[model samples]
Target: MEGMVVSTDAYASQVGLDVLQDGGNAVDAAIATGFALAVVNPEAGNLGGGGFMIVRNDEGGVFALDHREKAPLAATRDMFLDEEGNVTEASTVGHLSAGVPGTVAGLWEAYRRFGSLTWSRLLQPAIDLAAGFEVRERQVATLVAAQNGIRQFESG
Candidate 1:
């Protein structure tokens, strides 16, 4: 994707445009762009998010993939209940808030089926991002402002 390495807010759409301009397939672009968005916009597009995809080749061959995760085996209505049987907010923030994470699998299937690039190549972005991604001003300010409420996450 040329000149398509945009911010979290714009990577997906930009990547699709790049792919089309570069003579690549549509699904290829969507998959690349989608994964890029997830890595760049973790708070928004997460590994826990689920969605569906529809695809058609130049010859008009169509395929669809459902990438939704199922409920965890360990789940229960009271799983998030506190000692007083109340729904603790913490239970809705951390691990408990997490549902089945099928995003990786979804990305993997797309990359495997329609991707012209190697899986490793796509992942290099996320790896590099992790090692060097700068925190946005909004994120820093939000964290600082919410520190008192989310202290547990910051605590060791």
Candidate 2:
């Protein structure tokens, strides 16, 4: 392979490159790239989000890892509804709407089964990138968009 990476976010692609260059396999690159996404693309890549993973071993065995987040233990079908059964705004906004996170656990599970590099080593690229990133105009625009979304939920 020529070692090419294609990602919507450049930083994430770089993270993948770093992992692969470090002698890590695809699973390792995936884990590191996912972590880097969480830092560089927080709007959609936060740890609070969960996702699936598919891995194929050299022997051709394939495995799917389901890391999608689940509702909190305290959640219920009607928890966000009012007495009259109308959906409350709480059901879709603010902290109350958040589900339990599962990304880290899912990544760990996949790595344990299919990884070649140490987990800590794979994570270092993301951590270093996060520590060194300087906010740019694009990120400022993202913040403005996020602020508008937050304003929509604000009572005052």
Q: Tell me the alpha-carbon RMSD of every candidate.
A: 4.2, 2.5
Please give the CA lDDT of all the candidate structures. 0.67, 0.85
- Residue 96 of model 1 has an lDDT of 68
lDDT (10s digit) by residue, model 2, range 1-156: 246655657888988887788788888888888888888888767798899988888899988899999999888899998999999989778899888999999999989998889989988878887787876677789898789788876785
Candidate 2 stretches with Cα past 4 Å from truth are 1-3, 151-156
Write the residue-wise lDDT of candidate 1 on 37-144 in tens digits: 676666666677876888776688898888877668988878777799988875657766767878788878877788775566555555555566667676577568
Q: Cα deviation in Å at residue 148, candidate 1?
A: 4.4
Give the TM-score comparing model 2 with the true structure, all chains together: 0.87
Model 1: clashing residue pairs?
none
